[model samples]
Target chain A: MSTDTVETIRTTVPVGAQYAPGSLLDWSEALVPGDIVLDERVAPNAPWSAVVRAGDVLTIVDVGGNQSADCLMFNAHDTSERYSVPDTLTWQGNAYVREGTVLRSGLGRPLMTVVGNEIDRQDTIGGACSKESNTLRYGHHTAYQHGCRENFLAEASRHGLTSRDLVSNLNWFMNVPVEADGALGIVDGLSAPGRRVAIRADMDVLVIVSNCPQMNNPCNEFNPTPLRMIVTRNEDTVR
Target chain B: MVGARDTASVLAARADARAQGSNVSDWMPYLPAASSPFAPEGVDPSALVWAETVAPGGYTHKVVARGTRLRLEDVTGDACAHVLVFNALEPWERLNVADTQKIPWQAYLGAGHPLLSGEGRVLATVVADTSAHHDAFCGTSSDEWNVVKYGDAAPQGPSPSGRALLTLAGVKHGLTPRDLPPSVSFFQGVRVEDDGALAWQGSAGPGTYVDLVAEMPLIVLVANVPHPLDPRTDYVVGPLRVHAWRGDPSGPADEHYSASPERERAYLNTTDYLEARGL
Candidate 1:
């Protein structure tokens, strides 16, 4: 006689179609590999937004090159089990994340796996945005601007997730070239319009995204462009 | 089960350190600053550089160096550079903004400022300043903090400019959300509308960079750029290099000065103090 309300529901989205603009999706139906979503170029440094469920495909299409998409990720099941770039790299044993790399959770579990790549995928080592970043990086006057954190919390709230669920994420479509002296250089992007990478979920995952509106950084070349996502499920699987 | 085991071990280690007052510094081995795997392909192998570029999202990499100056270049001008620092030997150690703000280190991060460790050691020194000044009051913010500050508001996404420097520093130092302290962002590009209207403007030019000289054997993790957003489903990102770097010529020994446990503890205590005050 547990009085706790355990709500189990299923919502389905078609593949190759645009995600309804400004719509909040249920965690049960959002994140799936092969699902293509799109974001028309946002103003520079605007908050990026998105959501995903377990076992879904997620893709970001760089309609134009040099658009810095400031992004973030978190676990739906447990916020503490956030994304760890070092662990992911150590686990993968490679610096560049391409097809077939598994995204590890904070606890070092496989949250999802990268299954496809249209363009050379970007790095996850870089994290998402926040107001403080906005202010310090930009100027004191820009502190009040909207950012990825706000988008994540907003979508996560619908699914009973909270700040604790917020985790570090991967930066897709960005290009940063490293040098031998251990110095990092933000370079132009390798992604182009219609190019994409796909991810397959490993478990029931709650995925959140912020369409990076950052103008600073060469990853996007300061031009925040729109992106598209497409989600598809395996045939014969009723979701 | 294996993941759980690792989590348990990490939790146990954290708890044990807290209860026994066991210094994590003693357990941590000093590593070369340029020794991280996060270094991108094709750089001077001898130099321990942290990041070559920062992807738009939250990403990190490590660079090991000794006596080498680390540069965070805004390949494009007006790039907001959110940078953090730490002692590589004790990955848990980090820079204390409050202590950093004290006296010589305040308002600007340049030559002569001691980069504090989680254990309160002088990990590095700000040897140069290419930008206007080093930001002491602001550090990288967690998603949770951002939400608390702004309700249902979107963030200014990721900064590709030199944003990766922060990520690389975090990863190299083994820092987690709990370890996040005040960071400094350089070469930001945003347009504020008259009467509070906002416009996105490209602020940085190609090749605007910041340089930092390592004081200890510290790992430099930088996620110069932010991750891309999937408008519908949140994507689980794979490992990608935000930027690449070459190690400094001087070598790891030249960059770091050895320290005692007492000094390490003082450094650690300072970071703790700052966190307690929400700096």
Candidate 2:
């Protein structure tokens, strides 16, 4: 096949950001002047939430690599509508989230769309770790350890939400593969330092993230690391 | 009857009250009723292997052989049955709700849909469904959620949550809370609107049922509690009726087994595994 034919085959499905012709940094650096809006670094095992306005692109950077970013999204106008893993996976006809995947809500509406993704696959079914589950899986000693569930509770509380508001979340950069025997295994990640995935908000969305603090699994490679969050808008679409 | 007596005398009387016979009847299949009101066509009452009635906010777990048909009934209009399934041979191979939904490319589960595992095997098939209102998303309520809403959520309390009940049931089978994955809820429904809002659909009234035929040897856990999205203020729920009978696994001739390419492949995978083991 010709080079163009190969490129066509690769582009038929939305390729991961890493497979793009240019690096994420190269693409971001080419943006118009003054389009950058917010830039922040989240500490390991921390919780963060922000409102990424419609039309803005939120880029998540794996600063130290192999760290899982557990995330939940909600409509800024209506908390009743939030990300739905089943809807997202069913509509896409694929199990993993990748570029061009529309992050759908429980109502089957798009909340956000993946504009870029460095990781080849992202986990939507490997639920966030909880204190109770950690204790049950690892040991009672892990009961005292903070988990993604705690982080979500703390951050969601700031937005007037509670435990009932929590749902299965997306784990970016984490590797949880389903084996041939129907078992899910959380193995080492496929991400590396400086890898990035960018998603554009289809509507005003309240994005809650937990820099995973899991120490009992390879999800974080046993050591948590910091992450970078950058929001940028297209210059011509600036409002 | 023994008259009112001292504690020692009463204890001696109780010890002597034991039935003097072999306990073989306990293991024998006896027909409690002539027939099941909800049994599908051609299913004989004598084929029933087990029957149970789980009270509101109660739970139960059982291990059934492959092809066993389990019928779950909402005995009242307010019952919600949250169900989980695992491969009995390998507990780690449990139901994957995401694959169950995504593999069939259908988010709303109903009759003719196969419940899939993460490794792409069918654990069971929804052979029949009378209550079309089922939920494959928004798993059962948690203790924290129940406490926030009802002020109490102990497993044996007045208002028990499904998560707590399932956890307790899991312990009975040597499984733990970690073994339980996201479960499917029957009798309570949820629909997403055009603008992304979730609307709750309550039960389809008493007598509604769903039948699941196991495609593999399975450990099934069920907790009958109020759905988390249920809008009721008072913690009111009804009883669930469970009935199981021996049946044959879905073959290529079965409609559900050949419902879709995805389901067909899953059934094939299950057959391959079972055949290799001489099951």
Candidate 3:
């Protein structure tokens, strides 16, 4: 047996609430013409990940505005081939992401392209919060509070992920601006309720997300709320 | 199965090359440095494979072949060069320091230690170390950590993050976040107190450096930033200098390669891989 299997058995987390496909999310926020591959509501302060096939559209609905989702992507066939933020910024020449911007992989290829967006922009810098950071930023009392890192740990465990799997993530709906002197400011959010951002996968991409559960920062306004992930195939796909 | 097949085919190719009266790795393409921004004063560029200077809070990723020595220097004191190593051919098989420490019962990694991969392959060996210690536990600084420590005036973006830089570098190498493994923070020291609490300690001064020799073709991801446990009042920032050179030759009798039986096996795996590839 492989060493990875033994390690997985030692660290496997008990499964939590399970929801059927397309059962939790309402289709009102984003329109989907073809068959829905996956749809599930991600509770506030929780993490969820799924495989988004090439040609499929994954719509993330901020059902409650001002919520930031920490997201990461990996090539399904090769987990090592994953997303690159610096390359994305270099390829786009823009600090923030928007419609028409292609999310570049580590190998300088397009993993997904943002085809639709309802918000002004999403932060590529305001990283996801973790327990250690919560204690460092908020206070010692917040150390016990679960952050996106904990959520990712719980969710990624299903796919045999561990500490090595965690990466720098994208903070959707959060407002972080580069200052005049190259300083960064993580402050209030630009998204409100009902904001939806959609992307079309250019390859088989595995996406993991953490619904921001932060209570100390202004990203989520200290009140974490639930959201939905809707994955749909294109009209040309033979689903 | 794929790794085994590739290894076999590579070995066969090496044998074929030997039969042809030429070495397969004689054709390794190494872009020698014409101009390197990181070379120290009076150092000629001809001897260097590549050299690059990284700004404060910057990150970079590059691949180094076996027998390549990576030299990292802090231009100023109080900086950290967080490093992550990954298998260039098979990204899934990467350095696991936890295994490196657990198997050998070592607490700190320096000269004589082998960085092991998940599949028990030797990826690199520490050729030289100037610092008294380097931490394997502390990761990197983040947005909120900066906010709390430096207040709202803290520098933004993923500045001093080991994980973030590694992730960015991994993707650039056709890899992803899950490929980021625990890293080594050069020039940063941690001491476990009597109660088992880790206390920050002093590392090397400016102009000091540590060098590692790659045992396998591997990805080198570095974050030029401050240690997360650094209690400095000012947001610690410093320029970093990186120099790559041709490392000493590899063999079974190498000091690091012969450290232990397990390490010997891992080194053999690397040799099997390199020999088969004709490199």
Report fnat in order of the candidates.
Answer: 0.00, 0.02, 0.05
Candidates 1 and 2 compared: the better one by TM-score is 2
Q: What is the C-alpha lDDT of each candidate?
A: 0.46, 0.75, 0.67
List interface RMSDs for the candidates, in order.
15.8, 12.8, 17.0
Candidate 3 residue lDDT tens string, A182-214: 234467888776788888899998999999877
Instruction: Put down candidate 1 lDDT per residue, A1-239, tens digits, no spaces.
Output: 11123353554521111222332221122233332343233333334444455656665555555454545455655555555543455345444567887776534467777877756656653455445344433444554555555666676677665554454456777654433322233467786655666676576555555566554455555545555555566543223
- Per-residue lDDT tens digits for candidate 3, residues B96-188, read 644454333354667777776655467778777777567654445543445555553222363434455566667888876556655667787
> What's each prediction's TM-score?
0.42, 0.59, 0.48
TM-score, candidate number 2: 0.59
Report residue B60 deviation for candidate 2 (angstroms).
0.8
**lDDT computed for candidate 1:** 0.46
Chain A TM-score of each model, in the order shown?
0.69, 0.85, 0.85
Candidate 2 overall lDDT versus native: 0.75
For B22-72, candidate 1 gives per-residue lDDT tens digits of 333311212343554444235454554343334344444454544556655
- DockQ (C-alpha based) per candidate is 0.01, 0.05, 0.04
Chain A TM-score of prediction number 2: 0.85
